[model samples]
Target: MDIYINKIHYPINNLGAGTRLGIWFQGCPIRCSGCVNRDTWEAGEEYRLDYEEFIRALLSFENLDSADGVTITGGEPFAQPRALLELAGFLRKRIKGDILVYSGYAYDELKKKYPDILKSIDVLISEPFIESAGDRLLWRGSDNQKIRLLSKKASAVYGRGIDRAEWKGRRMQFSIVGDSLYMIGIPGRGDMEKLYEVMKKRGIDFEHA
Candidate 1:
C-alpha cells in the first residue's frame, strides 16, 4: 500500500467536476516529448508513503461531502499496478465516490497487461501526449488520448461516444529540440492559426515550456 507522490491538491477544479483529491504518483516509462512533469518521469527516485497513511490523509478531507472522487495521476499509475490495485480495492470497499486514473499507457495495453488493475478502476484516461496533436479538449492533452469507463454499467452511460479512430488520421508529432518543445501537426498555416485562435478563445495556456 506504499505510494510515491509528486504532490497532492485538494479541490482540483480544472481536472474534473466537483472537488477531487489529486494523487500524482511517481515513476513513468514513457518519457514523452513536451512532458509537463518532466521531473516525475524517473522510475524510482521519490518519497514513499504507506498505503494506510495515504488513505488516512485522503479521508481527512474536511469537506467530505463536497469531495467528488480520487484522481490517481502519475508518472504512470499502471507502472505500479499492484499498489494501485490494492489502494483501489481498499477504497472501493470504504468509499462511495469514483476512481479516476491517468496514464501514458493506452487502454488496450492496460487491458492486456493488467486487467486486474483495470477492473479496479472506474475511469481510465489513456494514450501518450503528442505535443503536436495538442488540442483544447476537456481532460486530454492530445487527440490520440481517450477516456474509457472500465465498469460495464458506467461504460454503458459515461463511456458513450468516445472512440480513438476519430483522431487517428490527424497528423501530429511531439518533438523536443534543445530544451524547447514544439508541435508540428497542423495541416497548414491557416490550421495552425485557427488552432491558436481557438486556444486563445478557450483561455488555454499553450505556450508552456
Candidate 2:
C-alpha cells in the first residue's frame, strides 16, 4: 500500500498532549476556507510513499517509542481511508500511545463511512473548519469541530469530560526541515499574521503553509 504524505515530524507538542509524532496527509478533498495548510490541499504524486518505506522511515527515529501519542491530521485523514487504516493499524501495534485523528468530516458521517478505520484510532476531532465560527477550544481549528473519544484508552487519557481535559490554551510549534519552516498546531484567528510579523523582525522570511 502507498500513502500520500505531506510530512512527518516527531516530538510535536502542539497537536496533542505530551510529546507526539505528527503525520500530515498530503491530500484534502474538503478545502476549508482560511485553512493554514493550503500547501497540503493537493494530492500530488510526489507525496506517495510505499508502506514499507514509510515504516522504515518511522522506525529510524531513535525516540519513536518515547512519544506519548500519535496525531494524524491533514489534508483530511479520512480522504484516504484505506491508507489511514493501514497507517493507524501499524501505529497501534508499534506505539504505546493513543492515536488521534483530525478530519473535516462530521462524527456521524465518519462513523457511518469508516467504522473499520475508526477502530484503529483512539480519539477523533471531526468537522470542517468554519472560518467565521471563531476559535473556542484547544485541539480544534474552529468551534464547529468536536473531539470524540473512540477507544477505552482515549476515555481514560482524556477523561470522561473532553472539555475539562482540554482546558489549556492553544499553542504552535515551529520546526525547520530542509530550509522549509513548518508550523505545527492549530492557530487562532490572526495568529499566523502575528507570527509572520515577528519572524520578519528577526530577518526570517516566513510564509504561511
Candidate 3:
C-alpha cells in the first residue's frame, strides 16, 4: 500500500495534547472554507511513499519513541480510507504510543463508514472547519467540531473539557521539508498574519501565510 502525503512532522506540541508525530495526508474532499491548509487540498504523488517505507522513515527518527502520540490530520484522512486504515493498523501494532486523527466527517458518519479505523485510534478530532462558527477549543478548528475519545487514554486527557482552549494558547511550528518551509498547528484567527509579519522580519517572505 502507498500513502500519499503532504508531510510528516514530529515533536509538535500544538496539534494534540502533547509532543506528537504529526502526519498530514494529502487530498481533502471536505475542503472547508477559509482553511489555512489550502496547500494540502490536492492529492499529489509528489510525496507518495510505500506504506512500509513510510513506517521505516518514521522509526529512523531517534526521538520518535519519546513522543506522546501520533496525530493524523489531513487533507481529510478518510478520503483515502483504505490507506489510512492500513497505516493505522501498522502504527497501532508497532508503536507504543497513542494514535489520533482529525477528519472533516461527522462522528456518526465516520462510525458508519469507518468503524474499524475509529476503533484503532485513541483520539479523534472530527467535523469540518466551520469558519463562521469561530471556535477556540483545544485541538478543534471550529465550534461545530467534536473531539472524541476512542481509547481510555483519550478520556484521561480530555474528560470534562469545554469548547475553549485553556489559555487561547493557539500555537504553530515551522519545519523544513524538501527545501520548503511548512507549518504545523491549529492557528487562531489572525495568527497566520502575525506569523507572516514575524517571518518577514527574519527575511522570510510568507505573505500568503
Candidate 4:
C-alpha cells in the first residue's frame, strides 16, 4: 500500500469516466527508450511511505470526491508484484472501484509466471514501448502494447473471452463518458476535422464536442 504519488486528473494513465488516482511507484528496471517519466527508472531514490499511510492518503481522496479508483502505475508495477498484489487485495476488500495497472511486462508472460498477481488486477496494460511503433493516440508508447481484461472467473462463467484490442499504428485516442466512447488526441486539428466529416459520411455517431 505504500504508494509514491497521486494525481487528480491523469490523462496519461487510462481512458475512463471517473476521476483517477495515479500512483507512481518508486522503481523501474526497463529503462525504456524515451520514457516520459525518466526519473522513475531508478529504484530506492525516493522516500518510501508506510503501507497504512498510503492507504490513508487514498481514502482521504474519497472524502474529497476526487478519485473514482486507484490506477497503480510505477517505474514498473510488476517489479514489486508481491507488494502490489497485497495492496490490490486490500483495496478490493475495502474500495468499490476497479483497479487498473500499467506494466512493461507482457500479459501472457505475467500470467505464466505470476498468476496470483494477475488475479488481483482488473485491467492490465502491457508491453514495452517500441519507439518505431510510437503513436500519439495510444495509451502507452507502442503499437505492441495491449489493454487486457483479467477477471478470469467472470470470463469463465460468461463464456466470453476478455476484451482485448491491438493498436494499429493510428494516431487516435479514446475516452469514456459513462460507457460512451469518444475519440480524443488525434494527431492534427485538420486531420481530426476531416475525420469528423468522414465519420459523418459513414454514419458514425461522432462529434467534436
Candidate 5:
C-alpha cells in the first residue's frame, strides 16, 4: 500500500493530548471555506509515500520514544481509509502510544463508512471547520465539531476537558522542514490573516498549507 502526505512533524503539543507525531495527509475534498490549509487540498504525486517505507521511517524517528502519541490529520485522513487503517494498525503493534485522527467528515458519516478506522484510533476530532463558529473551545473551529475519545486510552488522557481560554489546545506550532516552513495546530478565526500580514512584512507570501 501507499499513502500521500502533505507533511509530517514531531513533538506536536497542541493538536492532540501531548507531544506526538503529526502526519498531515495529502488531499481533502471538504474544502471548508476560509481553511488555513489550502496547500493540502490538492493531491499530487509529489506527496506520495510508500506505506512500508513510511512505517520504517516512523519506527526509526529519533523522538519516537518520547512522543506521547501519533496524530493523523490534514487532507482528511479518512480519505485514505485502507492506508490509514494499515498505518494505524502497524503503529499500535510496533509502537507504544495511542493514535488520533482529524477529519472533515462528521462522526456519524465516519462511523458509517469507516468503522474499522475508528476502531484503530483512540480519539477523533470530526467535522469540517466552521469559519462562522470561531475557534473558541474544544479545539474546534465550529460548535458543530466534536472530539470523541474512542478508546479507553483516550478517555484516560483527555476524558476531562481542559480549560479552553488559557490552555495550549488552540495554539499553533511552527517548524521548518527541508526548504519549507510548516505550521501545526488549530488556527483561530482570522488567525491566518494575521499570520499572512506578519509574513508579508518579512517579504514572505505565506503559502497556505
Candidate 6:
C-alpha cells in the first residue's frame, strides 16, 4: 500500500488529548472555504510513500512512544478509505494509542458509505468545515462539525464534557518540519489575519499553508 501525505509530526499537543502523532494527508476533494491547510488540498506524485516506508519512518522516531494518541487529519482522510483503513489497522495493532480521524464527510454519511471504518478508529470528528458556522467548539474548525466517540476508550477519555460549554478556546502549536513551518490545530476566524499582521510588523512574511 502507498500513502500520500503532506507531512507527519510527533508530540502534537493541540490536536488531541495529551501528546499525539499527527498525520496530514495530501489530498482533499472537499476543499472547504477558509481552510488553513490549503497546501494540502492537492495530491501529487511527490507526496507518495510506500506504506511500509511510512511505518519504518515512524518507528525510527525516538519520541514516538511519548505520544498519547494519533491524529489523522487531511485534506479529508476519508477521501482515501483503503489507505485510511490500513493505517488505522496498523495503529490499532502496534501503537496502542487511541486513533482519531477527521473527515469532511458527515458521520451518518460516512457510516453509510464506509461502515468498516467504524471498527478501526476510536474517534471521528466529522462534517465539513463551514466557514460561516464560526469556531465555537474545541478541536473543531466550526460549530457544525460533530465529534463521535466510536470506542470505549474514547468515551472514557472524551465523553464527560465534550460540548460547547466546555470550549475554552482554540489552541495552535507551531513546529518547524524541514523547511516548512506547520501551524497545527484549529484557529478561530480572523486569527490568521491577526497573526500575519503581527508577523509583518516584525518583518517576517508568511505564506499560508
Which residue pairs does candidate 6 place in steric collision?
none
Poorest lDDT segment (10 consecutive residues) of candidate 3? 160-169
Q: What is the lDDT of residue 196 in candidate 3?
A: 79
In the range 14-92, model 1's lDDT, one tens digit per residue, is 4433466677778888988767666567755455777778777877876544567767887788877878888789767
Candidate 6, 6-94: lDDT as tens digits = 98888788777788999999899988888888988888999999988988987887766667889999888888889999888888887
**Candidate with best lDDT:** 2
Which is superior by TM-score, 4 or 6?
6
For model 5, how does the per-residue alpha-carbon lDDT over 68-106 read when each residue is reduced to its tens digit? 998889888888889999988887776567788889998
Task: Tell me the TM-score of each prediction against the true structure.
Answer: 0.71, 0.93, 0.89, 0.64, 0.91, 0.94
Candidate 5, after superposition: displacement of residue 27 in Å? 0.7
Model 4 whole-model lDDT (C-alpha atoms): 0.60
Of models 2 and 3, which has the larger TM-score?
2
Best by TM-score: 6
Choose 1 or 6, whichever is better by TM-score. 6
When sorted by lDDT, best at the front, the candidate numbers are: 2, 6, 3, 5, 1, 4
Q: What is the C-alpha local distance difference test score of each model? A: 0.68, 0.86, 0.81, 0.60, 0.81, 0.85
* Candidate 5, run of 10 with poorest lDDT: 160-169
RMSD of each: 8.3, 1.7, 2.2, 9.6, 2.2, 1.4
Candidate achieving higher lDDT, 2 or 3: 2
Clashing pairs in 5: none
* lDDT for residue 36 in candidate 5, whole number 0-100: 80
Per-residue lDDT of 114-140 in model 3, one digit per residue for the tens? 999998888888888988886667777
**Which stretches of candidate 6 lie above 4 Å from their native place?**
none
Candidate scoring better on TM-score of 1 and 2: 2
Model 5 residue 107 CA deviation in Å: 0.8
Task: Show the colliding residue pairs in model 4.
Answer: none
